[model samples]
Target: MKSPIFSRSSSPLNSHSSISPPLTPRRTFPETIMEENIDYATTIITKWDLDGPTYRKMSSLFGDDRKEAKRFIEGVTGLRNAMHYYLKINSSSEKLIRAQRLMQVAMKRLEKEFYYILSSNRNVLDAESVSRGSTRSSLSDSLEDEVQGDEIIEDGNSISEADKASLMAMADLKSIADCMIGSGYGKECVRIYDLIRKSIIDESLYNLGVEKINPSQIQKMDWNVLEAKIKSWLQAVKIAVKNLFYGERILCDSVFSSSEKIAESCFAEISRDAAINLFGFPENFAKSKKILSPEKMFRALDLYEAISDLWPDIEMIFSYDSLSAVKCQGVASLVKLGESIRVMLTQFELAIQKDSSKSPSTGGVHPLTRYVMNYLVFLGDYSGVMSDTVADWPLNAQTPLPESYFSSPISGGSAIEDPSSAVTVRLAWLILVLLCKLDGKASLYNDVALSYLFLANNLNYVVSKVQNSNLGLLMGSEWISKHESKVKQYTGNYERMGWIKVIMSLPKNPTAEFSLQEVKEIFSLFNSGFEGTYKKQSGWVIPDRKLREEIKLSLAKKIVPSYRVFYEKHRGKIGREFGVESIVRYAPEDLNNYLSDLFFGTEVSTSTKTWSSYETSSESSLSSHRR
Candidate 1:
């Protein structure tokens, strides 16, 4: 067909040449020329008309013959261009009617092909494969080539059959979608895509165990049931963000590569509600009143951590302005989780502060000590995540802690800056609170010596727990070392207060000459003091084996040598007057043997021992001498 032309008026070469020429009113094409162009457009449109008898015999023009599919798309483009020309040339032309009918047929055909490719290649065009294929620039280039009549090959074995099929299906979908959207059939195209893909997204999430649980249902759930659900959510969220939503985005972008706005709109429409519901679960769980217990805090932190860890994926996938609510939901969940955890931590600290168990343990590890240390050890396992949760939360101590409390040698006062030190300092502070409560419990003991022993036992337990657990890493070696030294100091005080009287009862000058009367008095005093101290201490207990042995050795070293010297020096003179067995109740070897049985918590009966007989004999002999 001959193309139409437009003529423009020119200014004559005169004095007005420097001035701009008047604009020309272009003449319209003649009726004959418009008819010729419309006829030519009709021929191209009819030759590829998808509903024609010849094309119908070949089902799926895009699938059965890609080269023919390329021509059909190009023919539709030419027909659309010619229709625009005819409308401007003769808006009421009878010849333009046939081309418009052909246009409708071609669009319906392309729509059917688009639906067929998506339905038949469900596995090949799956979200994971499409997402994977979208990363390759070659996939885009290959689609362009297919639109221009290039056959895809799978010869090199570089790509799997599944990958090759995925590439071909994606290329077909992109080519057909571009044509339909470009021709203003975008709404129809987007509707079909959203229907099928939205179902896939919802089903994938369901299979991954994600559900649309409301806040009321979650609040009423038993913790055991809720915890199980939380565990399932932790597993599902990773797949939902990184795979399901991500894959849907890639498919949308690839198919609507020609229109970014349409691609974003389609993806947001298909995945927005599911994404919001998926992320909103944690926030709902966090807001539930029943989940605020200290024991449940870890699960809350777990949800916070999963969201925190997956945030980058969540942000990138929902980067579209239309999908901003999905991203906001994720962030809101994290905030809720963090708030819940902080409240529980506050409650836990209060429990420690108000612990009112007044009965003293028998020089063994107290029940409070065990409970607090065990709780802190588990809390330490989550230090990395907990640090982020509590980074801005300062310890709100009722009594301000002195700088020396954090700086104390055994406090392991290493000020770790941001993100970690908050939890470390917080845990350390809880332990300190427990120690203070224990000090009060120690006062319930009437024996000053046993009170010190109680302090030694409980402190040793605390230091040992920190040493053996993740607390060691969080609290640092300096803290462990300093507290260890404190345990030793307690044991030393107990030794002095507990056994000093026995050690002091011996004569200061053991080897000095003394008359028989003075020697008898000295021997009698030694026997009475040693028997009473040993009997009382045998009931006290130390639970740790290493500390038990160490304390025993220390007491023996201090008391044994001095007692041995005094007993030997006075035995000879006293035995000559009274008999060695009557005056000497214990040998040096007996002191070491008695110290071995000291901390077992069972009282050794002195009633059956030689010491009781000596006490009776000495008292009767003194009575007879006085008469």
Candidate 2:
């Protein structure tokens, strides 16, 4: 057979002359050996040439001719080998020119097929579906095997239809990508892939309701609107990090598994900008001045927590050096949120200390007590997040809490005992500030007994609040017990100061023999003192039902029994001398009836109306803070 390597005369190197040049002796292969090699290369390329009429009529190489797709890749490989062989032996050979032309035609076909597969499989290749497909390790192994000319085999019974479709499409993409990239057409392939995939990610974020919010826009928004956005962002961020960006990364890594440089470049170009914007929203929102109020502290903590919880995923997905800005943005949001919460906490403590409102006239719960306790209770619910935010934040050093302040075994040991208990100590400190303020407010009362009653009422409220909610868990049982004891002590003082005169009026022994004049003096003094005590305490109040009953029971044990014994013993003697109705004004049953009416808070004297106005004003103030 004529040697095909030297048989062609249509070569550009031969077209300029009709005669061949004089032969120079050189090492050469036998005609049969060179002819067989050239013939084999031409056969492979001719068999799968995509420029043939049949392939031209077809829509896509991968779609219309699935079997030929494998042959087509093999043909490109064969063409590449033939061109290299010809370049080494005869650089201007007609066979090399034909092989170069075929390579270009093959590249054009693969690029079109790559775009077709991507555009047609958008649904199957969505973020959720792709993430649900093969894991990165397995996918990379399969891609490496495919590059080495091994068919990737997956169990059809294992994955769902969507997952199977995604894997199959991904395999097809990587196959074409490997061939095209090997042939130096990577830029064309990457451009198409980047444009289509970037839009998908951007659309996914939009569907998730993540928007690019600026600080100025957040500042101008109504709190209600901003709160809604924060809520939306919270939900969107989880899906973005775990599914959207995660799946894109897996897909990119698998498709470009053959080239680490190209894979990192493509993944960063497609995902970095969107990820930065998604995380930057929280930072911008935290930077807004309007959300700095104490009332908005919870929302800021929620933002901090979402980023904190997703930190591992963020670190893993955006680990590339080019994606560092996304990680930086996420960290900045957390810092801004933590700073906002700390500022609000300071504002909250100041609001308690600076409260100038008069104490309630009835000596019931103060408005500040209700507001601060309720605020702390809500805050305690977020202890997990708050602990992280305030871990490094120590309490103010200038004010200097006493060692005994947190000394109770239940008050979290000592204030500085557990360095990890920053939030616990911070909350405890706020309550302490409130208690000190209540002590100052107690001084507003002129009547010593009412002042004690006020302290008892406010302290009892604080104890009840601590016992009822998450505060109980954070402050521990011992803390609640210690505060309860303080409440009891205040109530004990109240009982002594409020009714000492009435109790002192009775004789040391009610049955002691005495003259009618002495007995008359006793009855007169008892009548005058009991009436005065009742009139003075008529408007005082204890709002807590349980505490009110407890105080009443204590008083009954101390006052009612003794008074009853004295009254029964003296009544007949006093009446025999002076008329019973005139001297013995109160029957024992009458004391019980009056004590039941004590804490109703129905009427206050004009002298104490300033204290009475506190209820309305403080309630109004608390309502405004809530809004």
Candidate 3:
């Protein structure tokens, strides 16, 4: 997925320690104080654990409906304290000791910084926060991120005080969440939460079932018996999951790279639960209302066999609107229902298939079928080329990558060669888009954020100007080559969208069907744009009328009459509206300089004396200079 261009890991774990607020080394406080903090933290965790999923609903009990605001605030404070003690206690080992000292200092600094940040009163969905479910890391700076970071230091009005405060708090909240879920809560804890949640929902589902047909009246049941049955079902679910995902399948190739990777990831980075619905139909579940509803059936059938016998819609995201009627939408929930239904329906398929085969079918290939074809073309050897980092990504199943992740393919590839550059450009665009997206889904840029930094400083335009220059490409190439900074976010985003869509169309979860044109029209940018951009740019210049004539003649057999989509888009009416050719001709020197600047930052400074070559002159300027 495309990371924001300006993502800075606000977490103390960020490598760029100079910019980040320091973490206090968590030394053991007095035992009494440590005990109190632990008790408070445990209490809050217990409350959160018990509240289960309705914590949001219960938010109004506080003066404001800021869900768990007080608890969250207290938790933040207590967590810091507990972390201090935990670090202190674990500092006996050499490795743990070093980590403790670093964390100790970092936590103390963060505590002070956290307080400073919370004083602001605005929502903190700005560019500076939010990435990887949590926010803040040691990535290179983008203008958006740099400006935000600089604002705090410079007392600039890039962000309102309120917004800044919110961001600070969110950073802490996000960091803590990541640490807990990663090291403390763990997958087992998450599953336990899921089990409990499912038990509650199952009870409700049972009640719904009983209203239609009580377990007691089914001729073989009583209340305790039903309760026992439901309990067994819960146990079975846990067992099934343990069986399905525990060993080889756990480590198999998925969307994510590792064993503890996102299960739905392999189906293409969609949520694991979503993958089940997309690819695997609970073999036993059919039209049984207990597992599948008519409405759900309509949605799941969206991805069923198309008019083409083999092809299926490979990429189509089911929207919230599509799932409006589905009671719940998560892998665990879907699995619980689908698993049970599949077991029950296996026996009755013979009867159902007999009746279904008798009906005559009017047919045209479905949009999903086309999508699958498109995906195979797009994926092209990407799997073979995928990074080995998948093994390094620890288990994280609770959250899925956001749907909005987008980047150019050129960018994703560049990221492989050079991660820093990848982190830079992609993270920058991501933060800007995300900030814009979050701000009321507001105008894409606000005066305070994107617009403000743009106006406040000309850096953005400078970056763009350099980026457009021919020499700029040279500088970029060099920068990436030397620093190995990757900037390709494109490939990741395309695959993510493709997988999400494919999974959505499956018969597992009820989601609406969409056409191939609809899918491509919406997401074509991610998959096709980057590579397409390269193809278009590689031989972009017309070279001469001869070349144009030659191309047209060569393609005449298959070419459409129009050149709008192909040649003209890049040519840009060559008169006053300049295009790549213009830059290539008059500014190759400057462009190389620009690329160098982008890649090396200020490290590889260049002077006009070196770049001011005869090669940079227009034809008229060259003639005049010659005279």
Candidate 4:
């Protein structure tokens, strides 16, 4: 035992152990995490253009090899430079006038094609007895041919004399977007693209000029089913470009070292435009220098900015004192268009990609991330090496690329990753809520479905944005509280005083997103009008028969404000002057506000009548009033 006691000098546990059993193996975590990082190089070629996936696919076809794409881009850059030179020279000379005239003729053909689209889509041109077949005959055999023949008019002879007249009437975007891809004429491409994309919106502007729908008419619109198609179409592209933009930017960052400029410019352009459109047009944007940037190629033609005529006829409707004449309807339409633009923008993006593929280069383009990392270490010395390497970034081609790009991950996906879209969307929701607020009594039956759709989309966006944030970033941390506060204020307004107040608070227990399941879940309820009039009438608190049994309970704290207003207005005429008999029945809840005023506004104290006295009160009152 003494020898055994001396045997454990290095271990204290030897002295403490009474009975030693077999030692259990100690479990430890592995020192190295065996994660096989997959090489995404080939797959990521599509991810490099932050503009979008559609853009990647469109541009990826520029060539099978580097040489073809570079050669194509060189020709494009040359064309752009030439156009700029022509414009500079044209500015002072009659040649400028000549260019304008040439623009007009091109526009006229574009207009004719647009009418053809409208004619094809609907019988709007039924006034002309034009069949779809006849229209196709006049244009091309199929929709593709129709689209191509109408838009791909490449030669100078296609230019005509309509430039002196207003160009707004023409559907020029289809042409401009095509030219951007087909010709590689970037400057003129951007210019005409701006006009053309905006021209699509001009149809809505023109629609506003049509006859107005009264509040009564809107109430009967059956907004739920009425809005189904537009809602679906709107959602189709709303998230597409943004999503593709993100994936592409991520790939670009991963793939090349000089993608910094392309990515940054893409992001800056998207952010600038998203902010402007969401917040309502900046009054001075037209005068700003950014108007000339590549991102605005489509936006330069953004008709939404110029078209205030579409806003609700606020000046005529609301007296400036009580209500702000926010073009309530116009606000909704513009937002809808914003959603629509995102979709149509897919075409514009696709065109850019297709054109970029025509250009070729011998050396491989650097991935975007390495470009950023090196620039960071060198403090921009490495940036000079990137020059003439990355090729035509959609945003900045000519100007000396920014020294150290701002918004390095500039792309659609990155833009969405920012809280910018959510903020813009919520602001749009705010605009709609304000419109609801200003409508007053007339708003009760207004088509609230669209408002709900806008709100739900934004809400979904917030949740989507939040998911993008983790331990590293929180959605609310990115100054999204500003957006929330702004949106909440508007939603609050509608809740306190308007219909949206009720709709949002409708207890999500019932209403849901428009999925197949929700439709199936609510269809029976919908047939019973649960989603329609039932939802509207849910606000009225029917005083129990017991309340009528005792006046005290009837006039309790929860008396509908409408009844209180009605009671107040008639209190003087009925309670004081006419002895509460002449107009009591006339003060129904229909005039809730006025009724609330009548009761609460006056000196009558509320108390419960005895059950026995309830009968006597009505009879005696009638008898007394019979005089």
Candidate 5:
């Protein structure tokens, strides 16, 4: 598609020498008088004032009369001053009143006069064209020339004079909106936008003609300057929001109460500011008297909740794709905003890590964690647009627009059809990445059981979250199954390490009668293994009940039954004077109870014999004293 602003024209404006005859250069006009008011006015208008040569051409075509040019320039200065005064004061009802009067009266009169002058010169322009025959190069050159910085004339191809007047009015309104925003009158800026949009809808700009501009044709006007100004303001807003929330201050490792509050306040402030200034929502909504009487109060929308509700509107505005006929800067800025959001979220994770390092017990649910998850959830809502923005974009393409990004009808509700699916899946993957990082932190603990316990808790929390939310669908059932397996694996790890000694102490079935010394050795090994394991793990804690039970039951299944069988068989064979209860230390039921207390700080005996010497002692004691 052709560039929206500077598409290659097939008319004389861009035709080659073979297609259009070249013409001799005409004498240029004398330098224009520098009208101070005009110069200042142009700043607000943000468009070019006609240059000396172009003004001379226009002057010549209108019988050397500069009356219309002078009037239009003076009117622009008056309009600019009025807008400036309105934006400068806090309560400028008087200024707005005057500005509105001038806009409707003085501005409309100037537009009609300017149209008259242009209309009067049409016949002279046509006569000149006929005399020049096919030598159209002069006309093309004039159209190509930049008058003031950004202004241009489009040769014989121009919109209706009424359209031009309306466009110029919009340009002035845009400047006022900018000044209002800069002066911290965000609400006033919104008001100005509302006013301008209302005027457009009412077709009030066409005071000179009864014909109104088609809403569809509003883009024909040069809105690039106005859009650029508004977009730059929004970009600054986004930057301020980023710095306020995720800057070095929030990333600091301080543990003060105020320090934590700083993060919370930053989030609230940014969310509010972005909603009002960047996304253009009102500060507060008015409620009906009846509703207010019943409740006595009303709650404002939550920033995150409001974002979720309004994201489709936001996406529609920011994800605009340029076409051959329309161009918007919204897409570029939106991509930049998304990138910043992603970076800020990453920094939040880093802060959590830093905090956890200082206090390992800082593993509870945190506001930062909640906010990150909320953002990820919000991203899921628009992941379709995001996925297309990143992947469907062509490499090094000349045009700024990606083809049919959100508008494409070829989607099948898959990742390709719904880019949001990919983004949702990516967020799920990010959660896993976070779990892995937390797992690495867990491994730093000295107690192997405690480390495994920490890992199990984190993985379980993540899987539960995915299961309860749309994240599960995006990640698919398989993803949940995979993480569930990880949770089980961590549980197994804790049980295996915590019960290894007890597991190895189980005695085999006795084939012959054993001596009293043999019974004493076997019981001593059980005493040492169970006592040592219990002592080491007594202070360890697994806060998750379900996981703790799973670990306990698993250890029981491995060692308890074996110990019970070995004890029953050997009870009669040993013939020891000491009771079997004293030798065995733990009955099968007792072992089960001990296993249940594995993670609840269970008590351990003070004295524990070493199992390593049990083998040597069995033989030596058997030789010295037999039953």
Candidate 6:
């Protein structure tokens, strides 16, 4: 009932280029030398031919044992050298040309044969896509039909046998990929594994009888078949990783090394394959049209979380616990994983920024910023582990510790001061790093107000989380206070910058020169400021209710009294000269109401009103400010 997996190899055409001597001075190599070269090239071409059964014979002898697989893989070095020698050598002779074509054939054959052998050995549990009794040729034909816009066979039983053969071929390819990993070809093994998965997924979807799986077309898929393919693909990858670790001592050694490059490679491949499956095909793939779904994103996060939760198991698998091998208990691995996740979050943030920028109507916080900050919140749970691991870290000489951060009793006598402070300070610094990154994402907003508001909200959220969690201990109270100040700074900047023009319009200290002409100018200034600010800010939104209140109150404190005093002193006097009511365009009460409406984003009418509500609000604001 398993779905069939398929694979194909594109054979490169033979190309020729050779340098010739201008003068015919025939200095011929010895016959023995020429014969030896030809024999070596021929031997290489023969062994390299997967279709010739040479590799199959070797695999049968080597069996599935890791040690033997390594040995058999090593034996291919000579054949590889010969093939390279044939390809790189300068020759236009018929013999060389013929040999090159043979080499190409041998390569294609090996590719096909290896895949089939591996598939057969694995008993591919996902062969449901392939019809029973189909040949490779027929599978290729079916692929062509699908590509040519032919209808898909809806019946599960009608799945082509050629499809099954292709799947088997893919299995054989994975087996070879396993051998590659065992042979210390870590990067190459990863590449091969990625290619194999992409091929299977691409083929299955292509044969699924749909151009693209739109929302409406999603129901057309045979869920059982798709699920089987997904399960088999994931299981195969797991098995490959297990084989690589358990079978080859060299692989185990490399994977568990201090550098952990091999482990990183494996994880990268796993992440990529998982992402492709869950998130849909990358843009390069044909018929790739899946929207970024929430389910896929959450699943991706879950995969990362699962890995994070099982860090100890991963360490054990790679023998990271060997006392002499590594100095720390899984700290290095965890740090590396954290770094990788940060990179993913950065990419997500950029993507969100790009999409949001394209649509100007969208308002409020971006999901990318939320997702990354939420992830950091979860990551904060491990601050204790991180702090403990790096507790004895030497103080950074370049960046001296602040005096305020050393109030702990541990700072009493020794010049060295609190050791725990070093870890905690850096933990705080790391949290700041995420905030700074989120700030960068917020800057991508087209609306300046939205950008600042986004930053304020996120920065505020991060500070709260860190102070509330164990991360606070590492970062210390001083660190939390510093970031809290920064959030306030942002809010302050938003108020001051956005309303600078409006504030500037208020009259300064009245002097002897403040006559009827100056009074008219002051009224003019007030009218212009009210008109400009109301028009500019009316449509802008402040999603957080508390932030809105704080912003509005701050504005009222700055504008209410200045306007109330200016209007009371000058309103009647200026109105008489400029025709009474015309000169006093807006009353003191009108100024208070306008200030209250500042961040509420409500519309304002420019018509004149009486001063009944002015004294109470202005007195209250002035009293609060004095306190």
TM-score of each: 0.80, 0.83, 0.19, 0.16, 0.41, 0.37
- Angstrom error at residue 464, model 3: 61
Kindly list the per-residue Cα lDDT of model 5 for residues 153-219, writing each as its tens digit. 3464554444333333222323333333333343533433333223322232122122322223323
Expressed as tens digits, the lDDT of each residue in 411-504 for candidate 1 is 3334454467788778888888888888887887898888889899999988898999888887778777888888899999999999877877
lDDT of candidate 6 over 1-627, digit per residue (tens): 533332222212222343444796663564345445556646654654555666555544222333433333333433344334545565565655665565455444434444445335333324322222222223221122322222234233344545543343433344454434443344544554345534544454344421332334433445445334433433333332233222222222222233355544443443333223322311111121231322123222333343344444334444522231221322433344334333443444444333322111222333333344444444445443433334555434232545443222234534245555544554444444455556665676665655666567666766666667656655566667877788788778777766777788776653224677778877777678777877766666555677677877788888777877776676666554546666677776776676666544432212122111221243342222110
lDDT against the true structure, each candidate? 0.77, 0.77, 0.30, 0.29, 0.43, 0.45
lDDT string, candidate 3, 197-236, tens digits: 2343334334323122232243344434543443333333
Candidate 6 deviant stretches above 4 angstroms: 1-367, 382-458, 464-474, 510-513, 575-579, 601-627
**What is the Cα root-mean-square deviation between model 3 and the actual structure?**
36.5
Segments of candidate 4 deviating more than 4 angstroms: 1-180, 199-545, 548-627
Error of 5 at 302 (Å): 8.2
Residue 293's lDDT within candidate 5 is: 17
What does candidate 4's lDDT look like per residue over 82-120, in tens digits?
Answer: 334456644564433443333333333233333333334
Model 1 TM-score (2 dp): 0.80
Candidate 5, residue 33: how far the Cα is off, in Å: 57
Question: Candidate 2 — which residues are off by over 4 angstroms?
Answer: 1-57, 87-91, 140-158, 406-419, 514-528, 574-579, 602-627
Ranking by TM-score: 2, 1, 5, 6, 3, 4
lDDT of 1 at 563: 76
What are the C-alpha RMSDs, in order, of all predicted structures?
13.6, 7.6, 36.5, 39.2, 27.9, 26.3
By lDDT rank, best first, the candidates go: 2, 1, 6, 5, 3, 4
C-alpha RMSD (angstroms) for model 2 = 7.6
Model 2, position 433, has a per-residue lDDT of 88
User: Whose TM-score is higher: candidate 1's or candidate 5's?
Assistant: 1
